[model samples]
Target: MSVGWIRPVSGLAASQIVMDDRIAQAEAPPGLYRLDRNWHCDRIWLQVRNVLGIPAPRVYGWSSSTDNPVRAEYILMERSGGVELGKIWHDMPWEERLEVIRTLVGYEKAFVSANLPMHGSLYYAKDLPSPSPSQFLDSVNSIDKGETFVVGPTTNRAFFDQGRGSVEVNRGPWPSLNEFVHSRAARELACIDKFSSYPGQQGLFSGPNQYHPTRALKVEVLGDYLKVATQILPTDANLSKPTLWHSDLHSDNIFVDPSQPTRILNIIDWQAVNVSPLFLQARHPSLIEFEGPIPEGFEPIILPDGFDDMSEETQHQAKNLRAAQSLYKLYEILILRRCPEIAHALHFRDTLPGQITGLASSIFSDGEPILKGMLIQLQDEWATCVRSSIPCPLSFTPEDRTQQKRLEASWSEGVELMHEILTEVGAYQGWDGWVNHNNYPVYKERLARCRENFLDRYAKTEEERSQWIQAWPFEDKTHSPTSL
Candidate 1:
């Protein structure tokens, strides 16, 4: 029952960074052995591998507590020989980097071209019960209930279609695409109420924009706009099609032949792989992007002539920037030729300037200032686009422009309010601060200090905790942010 590793597989062994030293083999066999403490999720690796026929590590044998062991789960896979591409990426010549990009593009293009039953995560459907929306939700909630570190595995079809964002949007296995998108819009808007339940989050739930007076009328008005916008957009079939996306496609996840640096050996980490709308899955691969504004307006991404002459770090950044543009350009071409709706969704400079006006009020997102401006621009574009259509409901009047501005202000106000509350509660330092979970200890300490040093003379009962929380935010019931 025991397996031995002949030697350490340079890029294949479970590194200290990825897993513990305890999960090692004495020798590298024809197959790589992987022991995972929590491998409850069904191996979608096999499904994706078979369907896409992409060059990735092939799993030959696998077992988990449910089927074999009482403790760790194991996967024995054919070892693809290679050095870690990440270990030598920056040092590779420019030609080699371009070759890698060209090869990777081919791999990505092939994987994306494969068809699927629907938009969701891929799972092995054999021996599973037919999926339903309710079953999917129950499975998700059950997964959430389990130990955070140990994800439970299930063959439930419903388990695969979880959506992105702060909440689950596409809780599916839905019967139709229309239902999927409609449900998504409705649920996202509903999340506004959920965010407000937090004492610190009341500010966003209360207002339309940062500058506008709170009014119920404004909230109703925003909701109406969102419903209409979601209905009109996503008209193309590609926007509804299911496609695979590997979110963690960073350098560490890739292996390459050292002698022939451009040849990929294996791609690891498929656990978070999701099959969703092409728009959701079509982001530029991590290796090809640097953290910055997305290249938009169908602009060409160019690497400067002196890119290699620059410092090693600068050269890497330049390559990543160029790669980002190249990848996005490739996706743009694919979408334009095959799926214009998905293409339109991705081109923020063209469609986003209009589509966001409809999306802003319906969806709660971070980066309020940036989003508000984008929505304002989209509204103007939307108005212009609809102006020539006779009897168009989307036509913008001067009053409509004023309403749009009001909505932006109201949304910004709510964003600011939530930030302020979180700050007051010591969960965050400021509106623009990085959300650090590490601050939690400090937050608890501050809370203890506040209760010890700052209790009011009038508050002596258990009800006083609410009073204290309210007092910190100066919660004014008479003047809700959404008030007319």
Candidate 2:
């Protein structure tokens, strides 16, 4: 049996613990343990613990360089053992859940108190990524495979300058929060065109296609829409100060006392924590999100004055419903009063996706009408709260309406033709793994030749024939433009 090392003050043990491949446990004296893992700036986890003073495992020492054998490219720290908060989220009573939310809110408040002078990921100043454009883009690309457009997990300070028309205006670790917001929105706009050009996003049902119609009219117009939207955002001095935030605050990252759900033992996985806009950081802890639609109109859930008379289930449901809403409201109230620039920018930007969907509804039948209705609500909110003086740019002109109606007709015809072709080709059977197969390159080459041949026989240009190819449902196909 392994012996436990105890600290006289806290009475916690250093015992064998299992973590993922990125980290491993060490056999050492009690009160001190080593994390044997590859070294990276993600070790900023220790810095976070030190700064926030959350009741996390204490780090005695760390080796951020692979060369250090004693520091072992890892941290020596006290161990924390507790039930994972996620495992008990559903089982905890409403009162317990409420307490947890309050604890988390306090944690967030502490996080905001530590002001960083720039917008970027947390890293030792010496260890920060070089401020080169290629290095910066590569860093953003490294965060995840599927999501390429979002800015994150990069330490390059110069990567945040978004001027206009270009993806990056200046290489900057932004000095003010206002410029960071401007740059972030500008970067998003620049990504729209780049996202469209991605080969993986070339198909009709590709991620970009799902976002906006592939045609130029919808794409170009939305870029204009984004510029107008960004102009109305807040750029106040207080709002521009950067603060640290845990961007991904899912339940698994938290561990709590098994007996008292309200007590957090530790919070881990601080790899990508950012020092950026508070609006970008605030969100309800994911563990407590209500299962159904997020309620609208922002009414605070008023608990009745009657004392503790409700049944357990009713109380639990009420708490669950109100928790996310209350947190959202709290964050909004703080931003509105203290950082109105961010409040206006973040809230207004949230509605853009729904508006984009409304503008590009011809691509998918799923929830288009609902999205359209939501867009109306978002526009009204934007007008009332963001810019009551300026005419809402999102309001459709008569020409805009006519243009979309015409696009809808053509889109309907195209989709009908696509379905007919897919059915004729028998694509619905025999392949359940088109997306995951490793031999996609071999398959893709054959597909290119097929499309080339089709265009040669019946279409004037590859661009025209490519539309039909985009609509093809199978990884296997040789049909030409004439078939359509």
Candidate 3:
């Protein structure tokens, strides 16, 4: 399994990094793989972190390993003293929030600037099982003269999750963006072939509206995606360039010294960091990401024309909403000023975001309609998007589009309802049915209420109520039946 390095780390083997959570009936979750991923998380990105010039934990002694008395791994480093920013984010005044924005812009700048060559996780040479060059010794850019580090297979959980951790598949430190993205279809195919049952389009709302996908349909979608993706992706060759991203950047992960609350002390939880193509990595930090509509361009923040005539509660809500919109716009402005390259990437994605999203489409995605829609979009746009002389590999009928649009609309409606419920319950980001221990009771009660409300409003008959109850995602799914 992958091991944590003093900084961040990643590896390329399913046995080395992938894990399964369905434990009651499935094999034990790969504890070693988690250790491996955590070990390398920050270490691999040390150079970029160095670029930001942020103070990081000083490693006195560290190793990429899973061998020890505890049968796990740990990094021995000098700790930075700071409280989690999440604890006081809301309490921070406007000026402090602005400072937070500026500081994070610098991070965003660094994330976009650093150029790595391969699409994989970084690992120490010694940590690999095989010392031979044929197995693990390949990196276009080594961190040191002696080449202590090497780019290995990705530790992205998509490769390892479910029961696929034990299966042999190409978990690569891919040499090219095409190879990296092309692996999506192969990966799904491998999972379908290896596992008896696979998780098909799972989500909180998707549960009550179960999509019983077929093996043949899954294969067909993957085939279409593989063909169309080959013709339409990388949108820009520059987007093909590998860039490292910390995917998760919530306030809790960014620590601040209590004495200087606005100053970032350290960013933690560096596990699962992946060096992906710019198209995949191009996104604002989660802390800066907004909900609902945000203003485009660097427009000034202002209240609605009749805001003063609103009720006190309405005014308060309006003020909060305006502030959120303003902050997100400000973040964009900061990007434009400090990191124009990043700004350009964001603009490119905004205009043709589907190309990037569609690049990730495959059999194992949420639903057939979404998958089919992406493939269809790619096929439709090939002439204008790719400008390829060759004919496109896929097409969809008007009937297919009409039917898929209805399904997509239903999916969106379900997502919106689930999102409202999530906000009400204070569910963890993208939470399906599971919650952390500290919030189990509150979440359980809230979820039960949500389920009841859903039944009252949508469950048309006793059979429907029974179906939804069985499909309610908030319940513990660890003990649920599994196919893959």
Give the candidate number with the greatest TM-score. Answer: 3
Give the CA lDDT, 0 to 100, for residue 301 in model 1.
73
The candidate that wins on lDDT is: 3
Please give each candidate's TM-score: 0.56, 0.53, 0.78
For every candidate, C-alpha RMSD to the true structure in Å: 11.1, 13.1, 6.9
Worst lDDT run of 10 residues, candidate 1, spans 146-155
> Model 2's lDDT to the true fold?
0.48
lDDT of 2 by residue, 1-484 (tens): 1223321211111221223222332344566533534233344455456556765666666676656433335555666678788898877876677677667767766666654556665443345534333212222223443322122344432232211223444434665554655554445444444443311221233211223344354345444445454444344444434666665566776889898778898876554455665545555556555465555556765654542788888777776666656655665565556545555545533545423422331211122323333334446576654567766666655665565556555445445544544443332222222422344565566545655554465455656566545654445422221210
**Location of the lowest summed lDDT over 10 successive residues in candidate 2:** 7-16
lDDT of 2 at 325: 64
> Taking the tens digit of each residue's C-alpha lDDT, what string does model 1 give over 1-484?
2354423333232332133233343233556655433242234555445445556677665554444432235555666678778899878887687677666656666556665555544433332345433223211123332211111122222222112233444455444555555555555444544444322233444321133222243244455455445444555566545666566677877899999988887787665565555554555567766566666667677788987689999998887777666664665565466545444545532356234543442343232333434444545565454443523333446775676566666656656655644555664442222233456467666655654444443346657645544434332132212311
Choose 2 or 3, whichever is better by TM-score: 3
Between prediction 1 and prediction 3, the one with superior TM-score is: 3
| Candidates by lDDT, descending order | 3, 1, 2
Q: Clash totals for all models, in order? A: 26, 7, 19
